[model samples]
Target: MASRKAITRSQAVKYRDASKAGKAAILDLVCAVTGFNRDYARRALRQALVPRVV
Candidate 1:
């Protein structure tokens, strides 16, 4: 299998902009695919939401 490139900043923002319902669905998908604990994933996702500039 070929490796894919990392997601761009614009793409990340697009992902972050997903609807509340859609975002929850995506978080579930990510947790299932990565075998991550849901709580841990939620924390990490929240941290990722913090703005780097501030």
Candidate 2:
């Protein structure tokens, strides 16, 4: 099993934002830190951009 490190909230947000702008490296960094599939990370970032309904 791969050990995961805790990413700072700022880092996660930055990574997500960078990904939305089509930066592939951010996806890889997210995957490495969170252990999520590449496609899943991509989709997640896209979904995250939508404003949440309160």
Candidate 3:
């Protein structure tokens, strides 16, 4: 199995912004970039948008 790469903070921010383009667009972008399935990409993007507690 291929190892998963960690996304940088900037990339996460990009994803969060791209989400404003709407679900279909964001899903396509995430899947194309990360090679993740629709469900996982959706969940991952959703989680990324959550504010981290320090």
Per lDDT, the best of the predicted structures is: 3
lDDT score for candidate 3 against the true structure: 0.62
The weakest ten consecutive residues by lDDT in model 2 span: 1-10
- Residue-pair clashes per prediction, in order, are 0, 0, 0
* Residue 54, candidate 1: alpha-carbon lDDT: 45
Ranking by TM-score: 2, 3, 1
Sequence-dependent TM-score of model 3: 0.54
Q: lDDT for every model? A: 0.54, 0.61, 0.62
Residue-level lDDT for 12 in candidate 1: 40
lDDT of 1 at 26: 61
TM-score on alpha carbons, each prediction: 0.53, 0.58, 0.54
Q: Residue 15 deviation, candidate 2, in Å? A: 6.1
lDDT per residue for candidate 2 within 1-54, as digits (tens), equals 223323423244666556345457777777787888888776665565567799
Model 3 per-residue lDDT tens digits across residues 1-54: 122234422245666666456657757766787788978776776676678899
TM-score of 2: 0.58
Best by TM-score: 2
